[model samples]
Target chain A: MAGEPVATSAAPVQPGAVLLRPPTNPVDRRAVGWWTVNLLIGFAVPVVVLVVLGLLITPARFWLFTPAVVIAFAGLAAVLALPRWWFRVHRWEVTDTAVYTRTGRFWQEWRVAPLSRIQTVDTRRGPLEQRFGLATVVVTTASAKGAVTMPGLARDVAEEIAERLTVTTQAIPGDAT
Target chain B: MNGDWRRLDKRAVPVAAVTMVGVAFLAGVPSAIGLSGISVGVALAWVLPGAVVVIAAGAGAAWLDWRFTRYQVGAERVEVRSGVLIRNRRSLQRDRIRTVDVTADPLQRVFGVVTVRIGTGEHSKGGTVQLRPVARATGDELRRVLLARVSTSVPADGRLATFDLGWIRYAPLSFLAPALGAAAVGGLFNVADWFGRVEGLVGWAIDLLAGLGLIGAIAVLVAVTLLIGTIGALGFWIEMWWAYRLDREAGGTLRVRRGLFTTRSISVEEERLRGVDVVEALGTRLAGAARVDAVATGLPTTVEDNKADQRTLLPAVPRALADRVAADVLREEVSPTAAVVLSPHPIAARGRRVRWALATVLAGELPLIVLGVLLTEVLLHVAWITAALALPIALVLAVDAYRSLGHGRVGGYLVTRSGTIRRSTVALQRRGIIGWTVRQSAFQRRAGLATVWATTAAGAGAYAIRDVGAETGLAAADAAVPGLLTPFLAPLPDSRPVTDETVAESTAAGEA
Candidate 1:
């Protein structure tokens, strides 16, 4: 927690200074649904196989086993639904000093890397991310792999963030920081 | 240079052909037996087709080599243009070349031809620009021009004495008993067969020796095994001894020529070498000898049987001359101070030891557990017990993060010594460090420890100092020379930041 994000009061905007705005397009809800569906399929297929095997072995206990199978599938479905709410709470911030990303609700996960420490920045888009017009920017430093996904952002916004981070990080005196 | 670099021994192709045909015949014999069920004549007929295919493939390879192989070295570059169908021409710049190695097999020697291998560092995509079966004199001239152009260091004035291994010095002390025992065992086996032929004479002798005979037979077998192992080890030592040769030429390049049947020569620029390692094998240590190898970058991978990629850059030198060679040829300060350091937490050693112990225990217990389950008819219960037992071993390994690692500065160099069985000690100059990092694992965060690794571009070997105290490691890396290489300058006592005047003066001196 020694390197956690410190609260900063917003600075007054200078008249001639260029002010950058955070992207407004939210991460795609469809991508989240697709991921949830895949997770449920994985859980359900195995459970169905086990139920079929149990029924073949013990036909008289079918009533008892069917309820157990239904309960297990319902529990799995609830777990898959919770991540949608979790993703909504996650946010990413990029400033002059550092790049920060926070995810999760009950157990928060935050990673901050100073601008001077950034080694290389890479922009990657998966098939799902491409469909949603979102990209994940990964910043590799000497210390660790730090990344922030700007989901649902316009294509132009993602490109601008990647270019600006690259230029600023390269200008820093000590590459290792 | 000669453009007429012709084909190697023509006999080699035929020898290769015969070997291929032999293999084909063996393979077809099995299939011929299988086809016999269909018809006896059909099975015999299948062998003819297999023979034809094998002969064609072998002849094709030989014909391609005979048609395509040609290499020529001019003043600027060495060109290897080969391939029968699609001609490939690869030329390497002499200036960019690092080292030239010449090797001669028995066949190549007979033909007065040798293979010249030109090595360029990591960037060279192709295998060593090979000049197959070149004249020995031309090979020598090529080596001379390449070495002159590539090496910028000061060379040694005189040749160093060659190292020799004495038979008495290398022979193991346990040789006699084993040799005698082998002879005795052979005699016993022969004696049993002879007993029937000479029943009256042998039976009388056997009855006299019956009481102590079994004990003598066991002793003989043990002795024979020991002798064979010692003889094998002695043969290796003798080969290593005969191959060792060191050449110190005028300039800072140290050329080492070694190997018995297939000789290999390696050149290392003094400034480029990071360190020299002196390794003592258990057998060598008993013999009061050690093998020394210099750590350098860009050594060619020695391929045996054209299969495994077991390449190493460590060059072996005799122990008696190690210190003097390290001082003279390498031109680096040798410190007597032992820079070896252990991990901060004993956990580093425990991690390796525990894994080995767990593997041994599991291997020993697995069969017993399976047998017990089969006997009791409770396989599922046994499997659960096995899973539960694995949990503690997994936890032990996870918690056993590397610790107690230490490194220190020695004169103008930094030395890091670590590892248990395969102990590695790397020493490199401060100016050589390219970059470094201080990393903390999730578990290390809870334990308040970090590992620091430094990267240097000097040699093939990368120097690393691991699991040192977090703050100390960071400070050590920072205090060493900066990674951004400007030009080297003489230290100015005045604390003014380096100016253009100082840069110009340093460049002038470097030019001079």
Candidate 2:
């Protein structure tokens, strides 16, 4: 909060189109490590299977070897670069009135959902995320596509955010539609 | 509650049993002929006794079901209790009920009973309750009670639109006509197979084709198909909309009652209506005809296979009339779909479309070319010929799709028009939009384009403005819903002092 310029709902809202700012906070540092490990595991299984088939099947060895080599290189590149790339890209911010998030690697999306329209807030901790001491928070509005997900946060931070969202959403008045 | 519990009509037992017998009889015809081809003794012995046993079993089941099934219209809720092996209780809050639909098939009509389907605004399994084969009077009473809250002194006759036989002209112009025609041909072959005369039928068709020259045979076949298709389309239209009536009742419910053999009365509460979708498929569009569908919330599907949705307020009428009726439904002076000045997509959108169209052609051609190289000289010729013929058609379609892309704000609705073959212009309530999703692909980023989708709770969930200019997309979203996107937005960097002027609305157009 000291270094980041946290937006306050009390700020006067101007009426015209303005450049949508990035969210203030980055996810936990351990999340990058978690993603790298997961990416390695994800890319390893396919390469292993291809290599096994290549070894067993003599006629298709050439075809399977090419794919296995290609996959291994692709996986290596993604593991080395993508997790760090996404760590810089993905950010989330919550003000009294709205929750804003910036996400996606090649195709970015910045979503803003008003607190008054939020219907439910939930926090989840998967096994890997738990190992990394991280959690994901999801806020859904009545609209089908209006789900705001902020993943790779410290567990306590995710819970606190969820709690704040729930309290604020309840305090605001609307059918959430 | 016990004293108020009412059993379904007693006569429903016979109706159900008889309906089963009728279905068996109709279905048995083909099987019987096929069986008799093997052995007359086998056919006679099996179908007769099988049918009798089925009738007895159906009667027993129907009787037991009737005896156990009871419904109660309580003060706060409506409950139905049924099932033999495992008793079940289903109830819906009276206040939550959004629609009360009454339908009667030919058999049920004869028995003076109708199936009452109660629906909520949710698309969940428990969102509907069915009271099968209730007395017609009971069904009507339930509908009146469930839908009509207060009987005001002002009786809103509520009749907004009625069936026009002249609209039958548009029947043959629908995309359904050709499909129905092809289906009829398939159905004939199926029937022939059932009768073990498929070979004979094929021989007859070949003889007819052979007698005519090649061109003549093709022409004759096309003519026959068109004739059958036209007749099928007309018949289907009649069956679906013979006595169609759209009325706005005094209690603020829009009631649509239609169908010939199977009568249906579907009521929609006005409060749930978000907007309307005016559809114009290519065939109908060329003929100056269009259909209007209620873009309301809670257009729920019941357990019955009503795959054909129940949203049509006016089916393929004059464009002028359709627009007027859509306006009427939305309680607006002019329909936003027609009235709005839609901002067309940029010239780059056309380029994008052309590139996509060519890519599509290449995708198809690649497989053909590969096969042609691997197989024979004939396939090579075929591949090149197909490429030559398909290229122009694909380009034309792509150009049409480009022309169809537009979005606008008019009245209280945000209107979006898209698609070439089936161009639909949806006028959704601006307030109904709960959120906006702005998307840009890597290619789109290079082209300075973005697709912005307005997400809502009603009707298809989201409507997108495809390939809009990046700044324009953000500006539109920002303007449409004031303050929703304001806090997140930052003014353009060091350009100039801006008023209400739209500006590259990028605060964090990050490395992504």
Candidate 3:
């Protein structure tokens, strides 16, 4: 249930105004916090299983344990530290005519999608996201890359964005085919 | 019109029998080898019963298939009902039929019938209906009636183009030659292994190679492999394109009839023709030859589908001739691909490619260099040789890729070309472009360039004009598909001072 369409921060102002950077709205601070929780549990389960198997099966006990301990620490460090950088790079904007998303840390990818080509807008909430009161909006175009997903938005915000994208996309003219 | 269901040609039975017999013979080979000690007459007698049983069973199934399998060409749809145990009934809406292709393997040639495949242009498995072994005349008539609306504007049926025997010289230039040759070698080993003698063969070959010494063995191996590859390529070329002829039929359809052992007559509706793609592989480009593929919606894209949708219009012709053919296929005076000189991408694009090439080479060779230093003297020799050869090759390809990046507009089409290994220049109808995607990486942002992708519903679905100036890329996209992207473009920061008049005019235009 959305009211009126609100232009994201990336919307152009007067005809001559410069609006190059995407919207600066960061995801809920809880997203980074949640990812850290998810990361720890995700890594812990697999690492515990692997260590148990290594101790039971392999003869080179020290060799296996050394890498395992090192990997655990490194993984923990990445989970704790990398999300801050990810939070910085991750940005999304929805204009009247298109959707722009800039994300990824090491491989920063900026994608632009003309609203006309968008075939579907899906709002997803997994168990973790639901727990954190967050949702992801996926904009699927006719292109082969499948879709562009912007994660770490409030559930209500994602649903509203999906609704608006659907309305505006439907408003665009049809293709020749 | 036959509203009732009909069966395939009666000749399919004998062809089925013959195929079954051939299969039986192949299956019996190992047993025949085991029976080498027995008398020839005994061996023949032993194998005859099994072959007879297979042929009899196959012939019986073929007869049953002919009886139960039926097709009906109706007013609004063409329906095919098939299968023995599990029934399959597929129907294509008459209006949705995009291609009607007829193919006849060597055995079917003697029987005077062909398999008809009616395609709906959808690349999915369910998009086509195969009518196996129909009378040749019926296939032709079906094709004509199915595509009646397509050729209403054409005055008369005429020949458009035909294969030249001279084109065979370009066969070896294709990557298929070495690829097929390697496959053939691998196949030989596989077949030999089936007889349990692969170990002996490999040992013998290794002994021979060892006698020759490493360098001489390498040289000999390369020479022999190349010889086989070239000959295989030439043979395959003759088999596939021996009597190739392209004709504009009385109705609005372009028909390409080709092949020697297995004949194919594929037709594409004129109404479905959107644009053309000119392809130039590194070897073929070096030889001044190119191929052309059709860009049309509903046409199959899977490699396994009708030999990749049978989209090729001209296979490996002289680049000049291919361009002429591309224009003729589109029924235009000048090929849209040839009418304009493409705009070259920025120097930064070249730098990006060169860095990528070097990175790829380093990724591949680094492990070998490390292993050589740490492990053995033999590996050390290999590492040095690899570096000496790979470095120059990588540099050449990077430069070639940079040279390949270009985009242009010709007539009502937007053309984009790129790639060094498999260069493709697609002339997409400007009207067909449904959307534009502008991408700028952090590095590309610094370099002041962007990749512009024109999205469509046909061909590869999208064609990218890579690494052009950001402003130029956006302007080109807007110009190609007027007004689609203009509303979203953020105005330039410097525009207010430098081009006030133009800015005011653009603002007024935007308001309008």
In model 3, state the lDDT of residue B164.
95
Error of 3 at B198 (Å): 7.5
* Clashing residue pairs, backbone N/CA/C < 3 A, model 2: A19-B490
lDDT tens per residue, model 3, A1-177 = 012113312344433232234444677777887788778887787678768878897787676677778879978898988778677768777877677776764344556676777877999998999999999999876554347788988888899999999888777775325
The candidate that wins on DockQ is 2
Better of 2 and 3 by TM-score: 2
Deviation in Å, model 2, residue B97 alpha carbon: 1.6
Stretches of candidate 2 exceeding 4 Å from the true structure: A1-18, A45-73, B1-3, B149-157, B301-308, B494-512
Worst 10 residues of 2 chain B by lDDT: B497-506
Which 10 successive residues of model 1 chain B have the least lDDT summed?
Answer: B305-314
Q: TM-score of A-chain in each prediction?
A: 0.59, 0.86, 0.79
- What is the full ranking by DockQ, best candidate first? 2, 3, 1
Q: Give per-residue lDDT, candidate 1, residue B484.
A: 21
Candidates in order, TM-scores: namely: 0.57, 0.89, 0.82
The Cα error of candidate 2 at residue B316, in Å, is 1.2
Chain B structural similarity as TM-score, candidate 2: 0.92
Clashes of each: 15, 1, 3
What TM-score is obtained for chain B in each of the predicted models?
A: 0.63, 0.92, 0.90
lDDT of 2 by residue, B1-512 (tens): 22399998888778878977987798777778879978988997879888888888888888999999999998889999999989999999887888898999888999999999888766568888899879999899999888765444435656788999999999999878888888999999988887678999988988979978988998898889888999999999998888998998886688889999989988877877888889998888989999998877666744463523577778889999999988888888988888999998766678889999999999998987888889877888988899899999899989999999998898789888888888889999988888777777766765656788887877666788898866667777877887787776666442231211222222222211
DockQ, model 2, C-alpha based: 0.34
